[model samples]
Target: MLTYDVVVPVKLLAEAKTRLSPSLDRSARADLARAFVLDTIDAALAAERVAQVIVVGDLSGHVDEVPAGVVVVAEPEPRSLSAAIRHGIAEARRIAVDERVAGERAGRRSTRSHRGIAVLLGDLPALTPHALDAALGAASRHPLAFMPDAEATGTTLATAAAHTRFEPAFGADSAMLHRALGFHDLSHDVPAPLAERMRRDVDTIDALDAAVRLGLGAHTTAALAAREDRGAPGDHRTDAQPSSRPIDSTRKGAA
Candidate 1:
């Protein structure tokens, strides 16, 4: 069994979830974006195989939402999802080195033993611990792996086993890019609800509504409820994947 250091990248709230602008006002979108990252982190931390979580983003505004014990690395300059994830992977390597040194000083086994790196999109508010664990368990068998999003057109998760190169090409057509980069796709055969939960990355109103139907994390649930309480107008009953249209290309960088 391999324990993973899951790295999640969150784009600036102001620039995130732009496609949802039609469904939520700027302020509301920011709130919901914060909720999405917070909820994703919470679920990642709960995964049994996840040993550490490295969040790469400028979360100064949402500092209070980040749980204690999780690592926070500053987002890279120019702010692309791939850059953020690369920074996080660097941080993970640093942490692993430090742990190994500490273990050596204590005359114990290397603390980084059986460790892997996984990049999970911060937009997965519907992701559950069990679903993540299952995905990770499957990923552990491969040196490099990726999971496509619900629409099967984008990537939601990418993984690299210990001692493997962490080359993540996350953006538009990420699924195809990852496949071209030799990452094994884990989307072929996975259990029903687990796979569904893992693939649900909220982007458009339809996607958000789908996640809501699948069950959202506490933060996301509260954010939506707060909007409803404020009498804010938004669509929460839209059908999931109503069209054959792909996710907005402009909203590609960060999951």
Candidate 2:
């Protein structure tokens, strides 16, 4: 089976999930963002077709810690989502090259199978290993492939095989952009429920509610429960405006 090195990018905590500000305080939003990343990573790590999960961004003071076996790539200066993914892609390529070289020096063929690179958004609190694997299984058929977000206007996953160019267009109307760029859309290839799980990225309160209906990952569930435990301050604003930042495949502050 084809395997993939997945790259997930997060924005600085303070800047993440600002769209949900009216309902949550800055600290709460940060905590929620961190939880989202954790859950997303957990799902990616659990995926059978995934070879490695590379996280990109400065998570200092945001995430308490990441689990072992996951690689953390420092976010590039200027904090562009595209740049972060590109950096991760570079790291993935480097790791692949190093593995091949080491195997050659050992006078034996590499035990690892052919691998591809996939950029997955970090805001999929409800993502599951099965959903991701299903999408990736479809993606493996094409040199370049992408999965659109639940709304079908954005993207959630972008992938490229080892021999192809890894061009990730993930911000603002990303689905259309990827399609225009000739990346195969794998939406119809996965089962409906599993595809919804892969596309359920959270940015707004309504979106979170939708994800909750689908069942969220452990960290995301805990994060929400924590809010209730703390009696969540009186900052609830139902009229909160959506974040004005460029809407990406994931959350608002991905850049």
Candidate 3:
């Protein structure tokens, strides 16, 4: 019953996955980057309520063909994740408004556009179809929603109308910032699978190892398999453990 388009921020891979540096070399980091992005995109594409998947940035040469039915947008300015997300939201609104106006100008059946949009970070490899559906369904009933990360510090998933004042406030204390904006927190299970997907990505070696054990996305799976084939031929599987920085949940509100 949810109807909305989702905006996802896909930044340059080489510049991202910085945490992986401590555990992997440059090539390995790139491999990890490919995996996280591919998985994120795949999840977004698979979402049922997601009518349109917009990648608001120039991922030229970095990302492969955006999944079918998804649109690739070039962020006029490539500054930060907030900047990219803002650009995409504005564009989504513009498209909706355009549709409305065109219908009016034609004096025809008004094909109303989506009522709102949801901004999701592109790194949740553990995301599942049911979880995504549940989130969107819940959001559909609320005017604004805030989904905190496993640590509940970062904003994993947030929903707002195109006009809702969803100021990025990505530095720290993001949870409080959204609350100040009058958005309600809609925290879910943060399941182990969801947490792992939402938790640390290919940032550090620990995360990469986690992804390997969890079974990477198609692209990352292929890349990892290729690496294994070319590797010294060793059993590299193990019970991936959590990272050191678990984003302590009991931490202060504004850190």
Report, for every candidate in turn, its global Cα lDDT versus the true structure.
0.85, 0.84, 0.62
Q: Write the per-residue lDDT of candidate 3 for residues 114-176, one digit (tens) a residue.
A: 456888776665555556666767667777876766555667677875445555554366777
For candidate 1, write residues 1-255 as lDDT tens digits. Answer: 788999999888887788876657888888888889898999999999999999998687778779998898889798788789889999999999899989999998985856999999999999999999989999999999999999888988999999998888888889999999999999865687999999999888778878988999999889888777777765343344453434464636674
Model 1: CA > 4 A from native: 234-251
Candidate 3 segments exceeding 4 Å error: 62-64, 102-112, 189-202, 209-215, 232-255
TM-score of each: 0.93, 0.91, 0.78
Which candidate comes out best when scored by TM-score?
A: 1
**Tens digits of lDDT, candidate 2, 155-224:** 9999998778878899888999999999999899999999999988888777777788888899878877
TM value for model 3: 0.78
* Model 3: residue 18 alpha-carbon error in angstroms: 0.5
Instruction: Report the candidate with higher lDDT, 1 versus 2.
Output: 1
Q: Give the TM-score of candidate 2.
A: 0.91
Determine which window of 10 residues in candidate 2 has minimal summed lDDT. 236-245
Q: Which candidate is the best by lDDT?
A: 1
